[model samples]
Target chain A: MERILYGDNQFFAVNHLSDSKSQALAVRFKDNEAIIRTLDHAREAGINTFMCTTHDRIAQICDIIRANPEKYKDFKIYPCMPYAHKYANAMTDLGIAGTIKQYVPGNLFGTMFKGGKAFISKDYVSIMELLIDAEMKMFKGIKTPVIFLQNVMTDLLLGLGMVDLLKGYHDYIITKYNAEPGYITMNMPKLLDTLEAAGISNPIICASINKVNFRMSGGKEIYEETLRTRKFRAIAMQVLAGGAIPPKEAIEYVSGLPNVESILFGASSKANIQNTVSTINNFDSNKV
Target chain B: MAVRVALIGAGKMGISHLSILGANSNVEVVGVCDTSKLVLGALQKYTQFPCYTNHSKMLDQAKPDAVVIAVPTKFHYDFVKDALSRNIHVFAEKPFCLHPEQSAELTALAESKNLVNQVGYHNKFVGTFQEVKRLVKEGHIGEVQHFEGEAYGPVVIKKKADTWRSDPSEGGGCLMDYASHVIDLINDILSPVKEAHGTILKTIYSSQVDDAVYSLLKLESGASGLLSVNWSDETYRKMSTSMTILGSKGKIISDANELKVFFKDQKCPQGYSKGWNVKYVTDLAGQVDFYLRGEEYSSQMDYFINTVTGESPNTINNFKSAWITDKAIATIKKSAKNQY
Candidate 1:
């Protein structure tokens, strides 16, 4: 887990605070060129890891990164899965079978054979592997140290008593990809409990941890409690709390936590990027 | 007592099975399950049998002797496993298990449990195709040297976001949906495929499913087969499948409803002085209890029920046969996609 990990939400127009801002950003970064330019700027700012959602457009970004490996040799990608919109749209076009079919990795029938074998043996973990491999197709031969489950699906599966899938993810990331498994959730406390019960310890968790509750389920107290006491890595996100808290206070409250391993934020401009980085470092200096 | 049956999908083919099963008096339609609420609502109007959204609950409560699974290709693994593990016979619609590996496992389980397993390769039961099989097996077409199978339709020309068939993932497109019929026919009349090689072209719906699938097959019997299928052909008046089998002494040509046999030497079977003998499938269909699409649907179900009751020796479209077809499909798609 890096101390400062750049994010792709801003590049993909995913602002939680305002719909208009999100739409505006979508228009602003509609071109892949703009995305590449911003990503280069982030790289120049000394942030070497881009934790990104596996949106369709991200495939192009991955292509650019792979093409210029010399430029991105030190950079890493933390892929997030089941880009909700892609799945939703795919389900509409292909139905459940077709959508699953599309994600079957290369060697069409070979994947089908595995898909079939996985189905018959009730080896759902193998199917999960297929999906993970499917999502990671574009990032082939690139550096992916960690893979995160998108919060929407992670929390939904959390609610469904499908903790085995989360555990499967953890086991697979370690066994298959040799990468760390990460989870994003609005309800980190509950997820941690579930993961712990699934026998996963000291896992990397990304969540909305801020001074204000913002989108944090069960509020900030339990999040703070987990941060202080839990044996896990924390990547604090939404620290600005839907733009309610100022940057300095947001950074201070998040950094003041006992075990914040990383901060994930996305910005369209170089100034905002520099300012956020400075604020976190300044808060660390003040604490010292 | 009626044979207890449960159905686990409400898609188009599922609904077809529902219709045939509903009309059959030899079986009890115990339950129906589907993922979509609207499809469930539609099934509700057709059966007094209970409906469920989850397969596990339906199986637990219904405790059916047999399961009819018509869900998408991806979901076949779970439902089939659940049924087989519980020692239930299964009648799954084609492309069976989406892969040969899955079929091999499921087939082993069914055989281990002494449970009946059948895939819906309905063309095997069509009157004309049945005739072709008879002639081929009886040596009316002596050791088929060359074979060409074609199926054309207008179902997938435009962007159809309304149906799952337009998408490749859900087992969509011409190869899985249409050409599979041809693959099965090649297996039925000739021999199981020893080799399958070819590619698919996505002309109209490039981003979705392949619109066309073309394959070359070498049957274990040394007969060669060609497949040219296009689901996006708007010129097709209706969905149609046609085939031509060339043999040493004669030839056989057939479409959905008719078969024509050509004997060059006039050394044909008992009732014919055949240069060319034509038979319309309508003249061949025997009396059947319930028939729609083809008598094949009801006929095949009847065969499965008999196998379940130990009345028939075996079904021709068993999971083993489908395993071979899935293998061919996989080999062809691999060759095709790799080309791209």
Candidate 2:
């Protein structure tokens, strides 16, 4: 993982702090070239990794990167899946069986046969793998060093006490995709414990870890204790607490924490990107 | 004593509720009922809670103190009626019922039985919207002049095979699935819509139902607003519901994520300034024991569970309030038909 990972939230209109800003960003990045230009800016600022959701639009981003392999040689994408809206819209347009048939990632007969058997046997693991493949279809040639399970699904499975699926996802991403599996969750303490119990030792986990405890489930103290005590690789995200905290204070707080290997953030402008990169670098150098 | 709860319909929302309920120490999930054998099989395999194919049978066998219903809108009436008749507290998903009459009947039945009843209008639990309600009530934006409520999403982007969402009888369409949320928010934030005019239920993709709904709603307070909702908008990643209120003094724009208020003078509320004030959901949202998707989902469930356990009063999101939203829907539908 890169020390600084660029997030795709701003590009996708997912501003947790303000919707108007999100709308502005949505307009700003409406064209693919604009997204490419901003990404180039991030790359210039010494950030190579893009942690993004597997939205349909990201497929176009992947196409652009694929076309310019020389320019994006060091650029990496960490895809988070499955994008809930894609499945939701697909489920609405097509029935459950039809959605599975459409996205199961194989010949119709093979997909149907496997989908039929999975449905009959209630083999959720197979279904999960199939969906992962389908989500990964867009990032075929890109360098996805890490694949993440979005919090919506990750926390759901955790809340459901389905540790086996978490374990299944971990094993499948490693064995099939040959990438380190990362879990993005709201509850870091609970997910860390669950992942450890599922035999995934020292797993890579991304979560909201900031001064304000914005979306940090199980409270901030517990998260701090977990980061200090646990062996997992922590990717501190939402460190600014959705703009509640000053960037310097947020970075300082997260950088002072234990075992946070990476910091993930999203910004639209080159100045903001450059400012954040310098802030993180300054804090890291001061810490060292 | 934990509130023994039984869940009916283990679909998307149902499963979410089940997870939240299962995590709540104040609630004990005794049974789960769904029609799909596959869903039931998976639940049976994964969770220890008893699973059933029939709701009535589950109610009889599990004998829960409360029941959470997340079936389609068409089944809401029958399922809620069944639960209420059995003298069980009910938490049904919105748009409360298929018709206002059905909702009224259920409301009366639940009230007569003194059973705690709640409709899952989860937006009310959203912090920004909750803040919007508080600001509006405090006259922060002054007397409201006009408002615009909108909800856009990519639910139906293309011509496709009919699902329960596209079927009008199943409480499909922008009116029920999408607009009901905005309408409910408008009704709660302002007042119940007493009349609607210039209604246009346009179909962009779905054949049987309207993919978009537009109308002029007259609130009971005599304040009128524009209602615009479209489900076929591919630009939105998900359903984005917002309200822009133009008041005599200033204006307020709010969505699920943030609230922006503009005041004419320095007579602003505490923590807010004159020119423009912004607040994020993180600052306003209440904490929940278990969270999924958004805090609102867990907050709403916690509210219902607390209400059911007599720990909290049944004030917000009760059946009576949801009935008003149903009535608003009925008014919008009638206005669309009487198009002049």
Candidate 3:
């Protein structure tokens, strides 16, 4: 049975998904003395789980986590990798000839890679092994759990095979490493539906809400299906959608959404952080 | 007896006070004085009260029960002193005097005359701060630990480069211009501070006076405070007052607009133990309504009239409170560049 806990039952999970990847993390990371003290302020506000894209400056992330050992003891971190990392070894084993950069753009751009071309990507197995190994090493001796968030864009191609690929890399490291596997949902509910079709059930997924990619009807169906079939843990991404939404109105809008455990946002300054913190203070699960 | 009142200096603030006093049924504004006939001309359209070009003429002709002194900061001491000398209660707008000695003189004069004296720090009567004060008094935020206020908006200087405010002769810097609100905030939350460190910046604006001010106030009860007053940025006009009170058991954070209390619920550490629930009450908007009424003038005017008619048993007919604002402004001005 899919464990679908709701309404103040699960920990609130927030991911720093500002689209700038490493540069964004470096700018917002606490130890860098950035204008916005994201990690420190969030920890002070008692956010339990934090996720971000793998930054080039992993040392700063590690230093921040290490410095505030007790303060962020319960907080979890999830690192999101680009979609291309999946095709490394599989295509090579299959005698496919191409540059590493060519295969990555295919996975990132949905129309380019599908069916045979996606399955035959030479770097798939090698990239999976690399990611699993990096994660195992990155999460070593960490008392708080580390989770790998799999993008739910291409289940027929790569995403559904993640558990098996992770296992093949480190001999059942999927279960052995005590790593949590989460998924990020595209606007298409069929992607999630395909996960169930591939016997990959109960995936924890983060959903993005934005102008260009929002299929609310599809989102609600997938959310309900996830609640019924997969783990219903959701971190609301794209809450502000690149600052297009006013902070206060965005907060009120997010708080009104269903199945939202946490909202991920970024700030440019301390004042922004303070204002955001105040806005989030408006969230009342009971009202929802 | 009619509730006679005279407005000293028929300027912007004086005009506002006169209008508010005129609106109130209990007030009868008797006279108005201004050095400029233009100011008197504007006052005449607003009120039929006798207008004088001199303070002595206005006070003598009107024999006003109370006086509203809206003159320049430097002249506050002399005008307030004159008003108190006649045993007339004084309702003076902020920065009662530029110097502590001048303020002290006014305070002594008010005290000696037993006049109903009140200085304008009208923000205390504002709705948001009133709610915060009530919450603090009710132990909603625990023991008040820290307070930080930031009032930043576009610069609003009505005069030219050679204006009195820029001359320092008229006490025109941000320390006097902006510190009035900060000082009132300090008075409301923490008792008057014994010592404070301040820094002023003349950046961004073309005027000779400081446009930005940052001050660190050491409250009598050891609560630390920071008041950052800026007049440069135009991104948004925001006036925010926040107090974070860390008590032995719980913490209360008052954003001046709303109150958030962090007390441990009896419930065990569930998944949602650390989150906050927001309550929306409409008390804050109501306070703004009360302040917009210029209720200070009405209250002070009524008290002055009541005292003059012996309707009230006791009155502040002297200058005690005027000196308090005066000294606070002087201290802030003196330490304007001293950063802590």
Task: Supply candidate 1's per-residue lDDT for B39.
Answer: 47
| Tens-digit lDDT string for candidate 1 (B188-268) | 778887776756455566456677887787788988888898776754434568889999889888886667789888788
Q: Write one digit per residue (lDDT tens) for candidate 2, span B11-124.
A: 778888888887677888899998765567667777778989899999999999999999889999999999998999999988899899998998899999999999999999
lDDT at B299, model 3: 43
What is the C-alpha local distance difference test score of each model? 0.77, 0.87, 0.52
- Residue B104, model 1: lDDT of 86
Candidate that beats the other on lDDT, 2 or 3, i.e. the better one: 2
What is the per-candidate TM-score for chain B?
Answer: 0.94, 0.97, 0.80
Please give the lDDT score at residue B338 for candidate 3: 38
DockQ values of all predictions: 0.02, 0.50, 0.01
Give the per-residue lDDT of model 3 (tens digit) for A29-51.
43454412455565565544556
The candidate that wins on lDDT is 2
Off by over 4 Å in 1: A1-288, B337-340
After aligning candidate 1 to the native by TM-score, how far in Å is the CA of B262 from where it should be?
A: 0.2
Query: Positional deviation of B259 in candidate 1, in angstroms?
Result: 0.2
lDDT for model 1, please. 0.77
| Docking class of predicted structure 2 | medium
Candidate 1, A121-192: lDDT as tens digits: 233445568888778888898899999988866765564345666787888888888899999876688788
Q: Which ten residues in a row have the lowest lDDT in candidate 1 chain A?
A: A116-125
